[model samples]
Target: MALLVIAACQLMVVLDITIVNIALPHIQSALGFSTTGLAWVVNAYTLTFGGLLLLGGRAGDILGRRRVLVFGVLLFVFASLLGGLAQSSGQLLAARALQGVGGAIASPTALALISTTFGEGPARNRAFGVFAGVSAGGGAIGLLAGGMLVEWLNWRWVLFVNVPIGILIVLATPRWIRESPRHPGHFDLTGALTSTVGMVLLVYGFIRAAQEGWRDPYTLASFAAAVVVLSLFVLVERRSRQPITPLHMFADRNRAGTYGMMLSLSAAIFGMFFFLTLFVQDVLGFSPLAAGFAFLPVSALIAVGAGLASRLLPRFGPKPFLVAGAVLAAGGLGWLTLTDVHSTYAGSILGPMLVFSLGMGMEFVSLTLMALSNVPTRETGAASGLLNATQQVGGSLGLSILVTMFGTAGRSEARQQIPRFLAQATPAERLRFRRTGQLPAPWSDQVLTAGVSAAFVMAAVFTLVAALIAVLVIQVRPSDLARLQGGPDPGPV
Candidate 1:
């Protein structure tokens, strides 16, 4: 029952990440949001969720895990209700951010509860398998659900739908779960503040650069603030009696590699969803429902790979899975980059998506096992919180960076093609294009295509780097395996 509750909470948090994406267009249209403002719907949630995760994890330690879990679910439910009822863009964005705060609190606490409830052998392994399965499957499920809600019902249903799920989980949690005792430690307030603010500023800078150029005053200020704040955060962490992010978490080479791999892999996966959704709806002219259905193959393959990895991980170790998954993902992204205006789904999209899913599925499972494998039982919450935080930060950083790159490349390519387009056009056609303040039709195609391609290339490069790190830095051998399994081998990495 405890595992079930944890899995349910995880599914809710993960599902929220992608579900709103499919509804972005609908929300934009309804709310009359500017192009840049629409991004905040997703960014707001990600920023708060990622920023507060460290604090949330510690909260679970300071307060009872069960208490924090219930409180988070209730908070999430209320935030969802606010989002559902929002009449303005700002209202909705605030609600989403609040929802993220709730998620940050619930996610680590739930994982901590799982570690406390399950024994460290088959029971724990099986529980983790289920947890990992839900985490892997939730993104795809969100896409599907988001599409159905936006197409059949209303976009608000996407937000409203979480209310019942949150209620059910909150009720069941109290009945089934045992509360973890609170620990006595000072919260790392300074570290938490610095880290959260720094990340928000950094992400904001990239997002602003995407819209307003790198030299924009706001963008420059955000970047400067991020650097300063992050520096302070590190300094604070070094001095804190109980740092929110312990420095020793990165002491183990394999664990550090696992964290890095997750960061890159998450960036790649989130970027894929972001750009692919645009390609399907804007370029291919698919309805939200069709686009959602299009992701079915990728989703199914990911589930299969995750299940397979969980079974194999206990035997072959995490290195093989990580390396293989990264290679496969890079290949998949490379294939996706080949897509053009005339490319068919089967030839261009489906095959590559399947390959990408294969890598994503295996990479997530293997990295998850590696991250949590050696964490001390007492620090499981902190470790899982750090893992989740890296993923969130990576996604935000990757998307912002890619968006800026895409915007700049697309704009430059569009400008260069304008002269050629005007030369081939009649004076009246040229006048009409100038009147609209939009790029010439031919140039527009080139720009959008180039932008998407650039994003994919960046994603591929990030995954390739992760692959290299997995192979070079992470050394999980048979002897290490013996230690992990608690045999008569020397303990500790």
Candidate 2:
């Protein structure tokens, strides 16, 4: 029951990130959003969730996890209601930010619960397997759920569905979930506030650059604020007795490398989802439900990979799987770059996506185990929090850069192709193609394909970089993992 409660909460939190993605067009239409402005529907949640994750984890350590969990669930429910009721873009964005606050509090605490509750070794590994599997596959689940709701009911149902689930989790949690022993410490307000604000500025800077260009005054200001605030956060952490992040955690070379690798992996994953979702619906003219179902295979395979990797991790450690996973992921993205104007889902996407999804699942297990390995019990929340923070920030930044690339290529290709197309195309063909997004045969197809392929190439580059980092830096052996299985901190490998 306890595991169910925590896992359900984690699923809810993770799924929200992608669920709204499928509903984006509906939300945009309803809210009357400009193309660039619509991104905030996703960004607002991730920015705050990533930024405040450290603080949320620290709170779990200071306050009991159960108490924090209840509060977080309640907050998430309230925010969902607000989001469902939102009538304007600003209102929805605000609600999304509030949802992030709730998620930041709940997610790491839920992960930390696994370490504290299950005795390490196979049992703990099994528990982590469940947690990571759900976490990893939740996005796909969201796609299906969002598609159903948006297609059969209304777009607001995507947000509204959370209310019932959140309420039930809140009521059920105290029955089976044991609270962690609260640590006595002052909240590192300076460290927490600075770090949160710094990340927000940095992510916002990337977002601003995507729409307004790097030279925009607002984009420049955002970057400046990110730098100054992040510097101050480091200085404050160095001095604070009860730091939210124990800087010394980075002392482990393997852990540090895993974090960086996770960052790169997330960048590719997030960008793929954002762009592909658009390609399926906007370009291919699939309904929302069809779009959701298209991704079902990838999601199901990822769950399988995560489960298998979790079982194998206890015996083989993370290195082999991480290497293999990175290779497969890079290969998949590389294949994705072959997507053309005439490419079909089965011909170009499904085969490569299967390879990528499996790799992604293994990568999730490897990264989660690597991040949490050898940490003291008290710091589990801290470790989990850092792992998640990188995920959000990496996704946000990667999307910004990739979207900019996609927009630039798309505009350039359209300009060149459309003029030439008009010269040859029948007037009826031009009018029909423009009105319905129908391509004028070969030329039109090639142009859009060029744009989408550029984005995939960049995503492939990020994954390839991750594979290289894993090979060069992460060195934990199977034996090293065995030592840290059950008891005291074995210190850094």
Candidate 3:
């Protein structure tokens, strides 16, 4: 029962990362967001959630996990209500940022609770497996749910749907989940604030560059501010009595390498989801429900691949899986770069997605094991929070880079396509084009496909970099391998 409650919280937090992605088009249409601005609909939630995760984890250790979890769930529900009622893009973005705050509080603490609640053995292993499965599969589940809500009800329901689930989790948590013992600690507000602001500025720089070119004054300023703020964050962490992220944790080569690999892979994963959702709907002309259902196979294959990797990991160790997984993921993205306006879901999307999904599943289990291996009991919470933060931050940063690629490619394609579109348009269509300055049908589809393809090429580069890191940087020692394979200290979930 306790596991169910914890898993439910994990599902809600992780799923929120992608569920809103499926509804982005509708959200854009209703809110009057520009193509580039729409990215914030996803980034707003992720940036805040990723930035505050360490603080939230420390809060769980200082206060009880159950207490913080309940508070977080309530805040999340309130944010969802706000998001559903939002009248403008700014209002919606604010609500999404609030949702990320609630999630950042709830997610790490929920994972930490598994460490406290279950004794370290088969029971804990089973519990962690359930949690891992939920985390791995949550994105696809969000897509399906978002599809249903958007098609049947409206885009607002994607945000509103969380209210009921969050309410249930909040109500059930106190009765079923036990409180973790509190530890004495001080919140690193300086470190948290600097890091969050720095990352937001960094992302905004890339977003600005995508819209207004690299030489734009605003883009240059954002990058400058990010560098200064992030340097301050490093200084603050080094000087703090109790840092949110322990600086020395990265000293271990294996752990540092694992974080690097995770960052690269997560960036690729997030970009793939964001762009593909747009590709299927806008270019292929799929309905929202159909687009949602399109990703079901990815969920199934990921779950299967994860199960298989867990079974085989004890025998072969993590390196083989990491290398194989990265290669497969890179290969899959490479294949997806072939997509075009005429491409069908069966021929272009499904096969590559299945391969990519399986690789992601395999990599996830190995990455989790690698992240937690050889860590001390006292600092386990910090380690886990750092890993989760890397994932979220990587997604935000990677998406920004891809969007830049997409924008540059998209503008070039649009220029070439305009003459052709004008040549082929009917009298009424030409008037509409001149009035609104929007391309119709085949021209729009071509431009979109060009941009998406360029983005995937970069996403493939990210996975390939992960593969290189796995091969060159991550060295698996005998002790670490044993620890990964159910040694005395398995580390936290």
Candidate 4:
């Protein structure tokens, strides 16, 4: 029952991350949102979710995990309803931001519940495997669900669909989950506020840099504010009697490595989904539903790889699989960077996506296990909260950076082609180029391909960095894991 409740809550939170991508176009049209405003639909949720995750995790420790989980579900449900009925862009963005708060509150509690419920051993390992699979699979599932909902029904149904699921989970929680024992630490209000505000400012700066350039006054101010706030947050954490993120948590070398690896890998993985979705819809002329279906292969491979990793991890140790997964994922991204106008789904996209998913699947499972492997029962909530927070931060930061890169590339390509079009073109042709930021109809393909290729290259670089981090850091062996679990120490890797 605990597993079911936690898994369901996790599914809802993770699904929201990608589910709205397919609905963006529909939402923009219906609500009459400007291009810049439409991005807020995604950023609003991520900003709040990433910022407050540590606070939410700490809340679970101070109060009760079950109580916090229930509150999160209720808040999420109310926010979803508001979003579904939104009459304006402002209302919808506000609702999405509120939904992020609820998600932040609920997610860590779910992981903490699993840690407390399942004793550390094969049983706990298996539970975490399932949990990891659900976490990785949620984005793909959301894409598919969003496409189907937007195509068959109105885009509003994408938000409304969560209402029933949220209600069902809330109803089951009282019966299914038990309350966690409360700790005697005071909430580090100062730490939470500074960290949350710092992250928000940092992400906002990167995102705005895409539109307004790095030199823009607001963008520079945002970055400067982030640095000051985050610096203060670290100072506060060092002095606080009850630090929200205990400094001792980073003492474990393997755990620290896993956290860093997760941040880099998550950035690449989430950026792929963001740009790929845009490519399929905007460049390839795929409908929302069709684009969703295109991701089915990758999704299926991830599930398979995750299930396989759970069993294989106990035998082979995490290092080999982690290294192999990272290398393969990097390779796949490299292949994807070759995408061009003539590329076909089977010949060009499918192979790389499947290979990438396989690597991501293995990496996610191993990294999750490594992160939680040596966590004491008392610190389980804090550990899991930090891991989740890293992924959220990575995703938010990565997407913003990649988007900025894409925008710059697109503008540069457009600028290069303008002179070519002007040299031999009539007055009407030059006017069209000036107005639409591209040559007349036929040259759209060249411009889009260049932009997408540039984005994919950036994603590839991100994945390569992740692979290097895994190789350099994360050195635990199967025997070491056994020792960590109370068995004999195996020889070092």
What's the ranking of the predictions by TM-score, best on top? 3, 1, 4, 2
lDDT of 3: 0.90
In model 2, the Cα lDDT at residue 182 comes to 94
Runs off by more than 4 Å, candidate 3: 119-122, 477-480, 486-493
Per-residue lDDT of candidate 3, residues 206-301 (tens digit) = 989988999999999999999999999999999999987788989988889999999999889999999999999998888889999998988888
Local distance difference test values of all predictions, in order: 0.84, 0.83, 0.90, 0.81
Best-performing candidate as measured by TM-score: 3
Model 1 TM: 0.89
Worst 10 residues of 4 by lDDT: 484-493
In the range 355-394, model 1's lDDT, one tens digit per residue, is: 9998888987777667876778777667777888889978
- The local lDDT score (0 to 100) that residue 455 gets in candidate 3 is 94
- Candidate 1 local Cα displacement, residue 301, angstroms: 2.0
Better of 2 and 3 by lDDT: 3
